[model samples]
Target: MAITSANQLELLQTAEAVAREKMIEPELVIEAMEDSLARAAKSRYGAEMDIRVAIDRKNGNATFTRVRTVVDEELLENYQAEFTADQAKPYFEPQKNAQNIWLRDGAPVEDFAAGPQIGDVFQEQVPPVELGRIAAQSAKQVILQRVREAERDRQYEEFKDRAGSIINGIVKREEYGNIIVDIGRGEAILRRNEKIGRESYRPNDRIRAYVKDVRRETRGPQIFLSRTDPQFMAELFKMEVPEIYDGVIEIKAVARDPGSRAKIGVISYDNSIDPVGACVGMRGSRVQAVVGELQGEKIDIIPWSEDQATFLVNALQPAEVSKVVVDEDAPRIEVVVPEEQLSLAIGRRGQNVRLASQLTGLDIDILTEEEESRRRQAEFNARTQLFMDSLDLDEFFAQLLVAEGFTNLEEVAYIEQDELLSIDGVDEATAEELQARARDVIEAANREALENARGLGAEDSLIEFEGLTPQMVEALAKDGVKTLEDFATCADWELAGGWTTVDGQRVKDEGLLEPHGISLEEAQDMVMTARVMLGWVDPDELAAAAAADAAEDGDAAADAAPAEDGARTEEAGA
Candidate 1:
């Protein structure tokens, strides 16, 4: 009866209870409790003494002991457990030393048997005593701490692999505007910013969110949940749409204005399956389920395309696309739509186009047909006027040049005389006169440019520079880039050409160097040469000057012709 009363069944029951509550293994809890009791035992028996406690798994019985392992005296790595012959004489039976046998002391001994080889384990029983209240309380605290750490580690391991998965959780409580979620085994946090706009949660309400990330902290693993993330919608669709889960349909990209509207680009690997139709489900049931989960977020299941132009057309859904002008260099696309559909294409506050841009990964500039036409005409007029001013050509002749696909004076200055003669209402004599007049106009323009450049206070250093022409000097002076130092600070775009910002969109660039056909490399060389001239760079005058001389010769040739189209073409024909 006494043994039954002290069986400690309550301790075994408590370990089982805690294990169930903490969602951990019962054996782990029992081990933690045993280690805790051993630690508490050390406080009483002195820490230097080896003390251990083991709890019986079948019954509630407990055993206490001190463990010592016999190791070779020469092996100090386990010196605490190791013992020499004299130290362990009380434990080991000694035998007489054989002839030629030497003891560790290098002296003859009565017994020098090869005793206490490495790793000879030995245990001593210790009397079990009733622990005081203070000791019991300390043991309890150690057990709780160890169990709590083990629980945290278990939860981290469980959920860490499930990151990026859609998880269902219940609202536990709100802490500082963040919702604490009870996700079965562990807790998760849905931060305020990660919540969908205008969506609220009540205590004990079941909700679903994306497991955005999981981070192990000193306290526990922080499982971050999000309802507003773009992936959240994607995961919801993956849950409702079998095609996506089955790999028949692939979600290429997702963009969400969270709760307001969202778009998903879907493509099908299997030609037989319609990705958009599969995502929409029977009578839109699939997408509708996702929308409901998102608190009525409008969903647009766009068909994705491998071609960028086709994909962009699908991205801006519910609005018809008339034309798309893609600028590969600028990573931009201009969409021309019906005038009536502009507002819808752009959406309320530009939300539609903004989402489309995110989904397509391209800058979208939506314009009306009339706007594109007006822009084209404006460009034509600018070119026509430039020709009239620079080549002494009449409006009719300039318009004729522009009509023939001539954008700059260089095109006109270098074409074959026969190409000019081939034009309607133009004879060989007229062509010759036109070429001579064009040459004369450029030469006069050059002389006038020298006077204007000097009048505009161009630096004498720049004026005497071996490679700079009068026309280039005039351009530099006109643009407030006169001195070599001034030129060094300008970017390639500023020297060559770049777009102007309009309504946060880039418009056409009208830099002066564009008309002269200054290339990007040539602009860079110009800046480097200026740096050399100011002695800001190492003396590369020979190399820089040589490159600069080539640029100058190009400019000189450009100035000599100036719409004198037949100058170079005749040589090519010859």
Candidate 2:
């Protein structure tokens, strides 16, 4: 192969053909050709010479050149390609009137007298190389390598933004239980675990899957598709329901026991359109479309509610809920159902409750009405026993305290006198006696806990920390945090129990002071206060940071307000 006059245009034609086949820019292919030609020229000329090739985009003419750069004496390492400033003077002699030559090279304009400034370049046209058999093969390999890289880059850029969408493709083949799908412009992998149940595919079979992820790997752009994702079901609804696609109704949440059962919570922006009815469609047509795609997976379309209890009740469909007890601090809920509805609420193998948990983003505990009553009775008896032993009261008096919602000695000891007096048969003197007994018991327990903490080598500094109770101090000491310094060094999550994700499940990490009713926010405040007291943190700096954070939050809220108001105004105008 040679860069002859008759064949010059052939180079550009080949580049365009390759670029079109690879779906990349033609300029990229031309640049790769230039690199391969330059390498071959270097092999033919002196190997040390700096050779470069450029192809004219308009006429497809090839220009070969040798370049040498003027550099500082100490930095000039390649003798053939770089020259020291002194050796480059001849190249600059003809351009003596070039304005501010010294200044352009970082010297003062007033000192504009120039020999050859460092970084000045010299170039001369060179004869094009005649490629022999081995040289042609080497150039071909270089061009192929560059073209493959450009193709990969183009593919990555094309698919990166397409993730989280649904795509249709033809099944190419199966490799190691993974289905290879030809997605027109690129190939995608549908991993075995991402398939719904025992779904199988053969070559040339058409498949629709969620674009779960798009990653740029060393080999190529990897597109991962999934059929078992909950978002897959949500997207299917969006496709089938016109209201969803038009944003009249929004899918609030979706939970799927892929191939078995799924639940989708939806809400409508327009009150006229019922989200559930719109999703279910006339005669269940729209829902049936989604269900058919999901391999007959049963779907429960429920109307989403801001009230969690109401939403949970709706999520557990065809079952009667007697009551819902929500513990906001624990972020868990208890649902009490009728005895007959217990099995339905739980579903087969607890699938109903599990999907409901996923949909609500909360852990759920289901119990029968009879079981709830038993648990309540047991709690009442425990509180009654506590009052009887701690206050030296009769069982009837204890029962009265429990009935009045007095659960602990702390409330009995610290509550307003009027509250205790409001109880039937309780006079001022009786109320005073009851409070005195409660306070005595509380004080004794605190003193015992403090003594134990001191025995465990707890420092006076730790014992005197304002936020920690005696029981909290004792718990910290038991956990080897016996000093104020140790307390300050602890993480907020270590001082207050938090949930951690382990093996794809959220597990609870119990904290030392958790049993003492310490919240994460309270723990953070106490630890920061301790650091400030120990002169480890500046209170002024902390206040400044907090102020900046609040300002940012205010700005974000302000930005959101107008958009919401505009939506409301539009609705009103309509």
Candidate 3:
């Protein structure tokens, strides 16, 4: 326990081992030891005394000395604030009333002797104070502290450049629900806000994150890592997809509903490569790895197209598409699909189309097959009438739509009253009238449908098909569909089949087309005229029927297509 000098060598070896482990030089430790001794000397000696300490670097040993100032004749006057020459007389009795008294050689030998007065001198013969065990222990602590400071500086230098760069880390601890990651050099703070919603980490778990920021605080530099930032996803792609990293493919835009689905728009500058395929990799292994990192979140990597309709179609994935009509000025798209596919195109809760619209930066409206068909028919009818009117009288009615680049009534229906007024020669009143006319057409169609439903439940007297009469036909001729071709083209019989009361009950066809509007005689004449014009009823039959019609003047042939016979074989043979 007390092997003295031999034990000191062992302690020196232990100190040297710690210094090497902490990357601190032994010379700094020795300097720290000397500094501690000087501080100790200052506390032991009075403030008027001077002290200094020096260490031998080779031996790890410390030495100290005490110093006194060599006083001159100037100290006799104003240096002492508390004790003036007169006031200090009791302390120095012989100089009671003498202001200019200089100490005579060997006048008095006392503790208050000033400097080397009366020929005093320093003796360089004094040996160094032998440091006791307690001073040695204090020196060890100071040395260790200096070593820690040096190591901290080294650590800071190593990691400073790594700031703002992603790194793999292990979960070291979780304090107050905040996870601390050990990223080799130092700990990084992963705040709750920086965490992805679908991910969770436990102690010792390995995770990757973006180094968002690094701050030099008092204790040390703080590394801030984020997993939720959109840049993190971009960076992840850059790391995983070789094409993007190589700059062959570029990511245009990224929109995400994080932890559920994300949409990324990408394009390739090179014609040989496909951007989407590159991101997806062979059999989707590339994106699958990324999705696994994001905890099974779905990623839709769509090809970025210059055409907005094409891009929007890709954005709304898994939806069967029929057609897309986009108006760039209005920034809207009308999506058309089969009637049964409407629900799919719109998606569950409309999320598919909604996200697509967001990704493509366009407003989308979905339409069913029937609605699209009606629209096409209305457009055709409008175009044909305009052409016929302009051709017959040189009124340029067709040019009205053509000049505006509109070929259809559907386009007119979409034009607002204000927009219509902006067109040349369209006054506000005229625009309003045109809008009213368009609306009336829609309303009349709806009312006809309603009246047809009503007649299905009640007697046909309240819901007569007035155009069945000759007088009514003349009136309806002004509304177009004047000829048999026009009437057949619109599938009038389909409308006839649905005629019913509003309550949806069937009504008796009691010659109702007559009393409520046109009479029976006129209805029969109109049917005969339609049959003759359509070439369905022969001229001889029409003549005979007219003779018979004049006697009885009742109903005529019902409108129906002939049954399909062996026409399929005949057409195939032809």
Candidate 4:
């Protein structure tokens, strides 16, 4: 048999073993022992039989006891008193019921129930014994679970704020094709897709990424991260550009063809400060920082303009613009570049112009000098035909008859048949044939001329001159703006804003003329046509000679009217 103190020391050693093996606290062993002993005693004796058990955490010492009631004749009935009523005969009853004491039944039984039988056993001291391995293991598991629960709560508090923030981490280890990054406070998952193209990773390599998500999984906290998102660029720039952070400059939009190039639109509230310059920073330091973050991808910081043409021209930077022909109705623009600059303007694989078009919200039609010229020629030919068709004569026959000394079709058609016959080529048969042909041509020409004078519906007032290409004509038509007269009537600055095509193609701006196929001379010609059609000019004084011509016509009309009046008066007088 183990002595009390020796058994206590052995219990302490067992608790320490359990604590180390299960990684649980030693104090829990003493607590479990005390609880088990108290429960055992309660099962062996009724719950009403008072019992107690205690265990010392330091020594693992345990004690168990039973509390007994002291009773006499009066006390046996109450189970709490020590005196009998016979000791105070006058004060209480000491009859038959008194010797019978309280029994389980409410009525007194025949059997004697004095406070206690001399042979009744009241309490027993149960000693601690070795617990089964499974019981010890189960207790250890419960303690460890509690410890882990506390540890998880601590970790969650540490990492939740870091979600969605950009972080730099060292590659810790990789598992199941996913890489784990040590983000100081916790581990973050670097998904395979988030790895930059052509970028390799190894243990201990430093990497930068945006925290995409943080979630609590069964094992622990999980953090998801990414590197390729465009917002990553925006966030980096905001860190670099003070104006953006201060809200003085706004980044309106960002677009990227990642790993290659990116375009950002910016606007500033203050007109004095350029938004592009502010974003670019001093000597390009601010933008360069963002570029470094992106691994050398080109960044174009374009100043956002209300005019689509101007915006596009800016978006296609490094390539000079000769002109911007805007078509507002169709949201398109044609960018004209000189023949030599065409390749530069279009860029490799046409990516430059294509991205520019997308960035500026315009359908860009890039035109070369030859294409522009052909386009202009076609437009001129159409207008010339329309103009000629409106004249009251068969255009070919009118020229022919005019060469033959008949100035107008009316004069040719009105000639006498005999007079026509008198001419060298005019036999009676030829004369009749020529005269008949003249009348038919005249009627057809007249009808066409009338139709030409009237135009096609409400878009009529805008007379697009024959000389301008469809690009130019379409641009002017969209402004509710008409001919050069209408265009020039407004100040040059007014037309400087953008315009679009009916089908949404952008007309190239005039500034692009040299770079496009048009020379300075052609630009001037188009500008002149634009100016003349719009009727813009410095105010010139009306000539004093205008009064003399009016006076002369007035006198001639007066003299003619009086002569007719005098003839009528003479007839009345007669």
Model 1 alpha-carbon drift over 4 Å, by segment = 1-11, 56-130, 374-574
Per-prediction TM-score:
0.62, 0.89, 0.43, 0.41
Clash pairs detected, candidate 1:
412-565, 413-564, 413-565, 415-565
lDDT by residue for model 2 (389-467), tens? 9899999999999999998999999999999999999999999999999999999999999999999999999999998
Error of 2 at 310 (Å): 0.7
Q: Which regions of candidate 3 fall more than 4 Å away from where they truly are?
A: 1-16, 23-149, 198-202, 304-574
Give the per-residue lDDT digits (tens) of candidate 1, residues 50-108. 77788888877777776665555675454444466456656654333221122333333
Where does model 2 exceed 4 Å of error? 1-6, 45-49, 95-113, 504-506, 527-574
Model 2 alpha-carbon miss at residue 441, Å: 2.6
Number of clashes found in candidate 1: 4
Highest TM-score: which candidate? Answer: 2
Best by lDDT: 2
Error of 2 at 175 (Å): 1.2
lDDT of 1: 0.77
- lDDT against the true structure, per candidate, is 0.77, 0.86, 0.59, 0.59
Count of clashes in candidate 2? 0
Question: 1-574, model 4: which lDDT tens digit per residue?
Answer: 2225356777678767765654556665555555555555554554555556766666666766653333344335423222243432232222343221332224432443343332222333444443445545554565456545444555666677777668889998877657899987567898877765656678999988887877887787878987766667777778898888897777766666556777777777766667777777777788888887777778877777655666777777767778877744332478888888888788778777876766765568888877887986675555445324544434553344444555344565688777656555447876666666667776775455334433322134344455444334344444444445554454332343334466645554433212223344444445555564455532232234557778999997875311100000000000
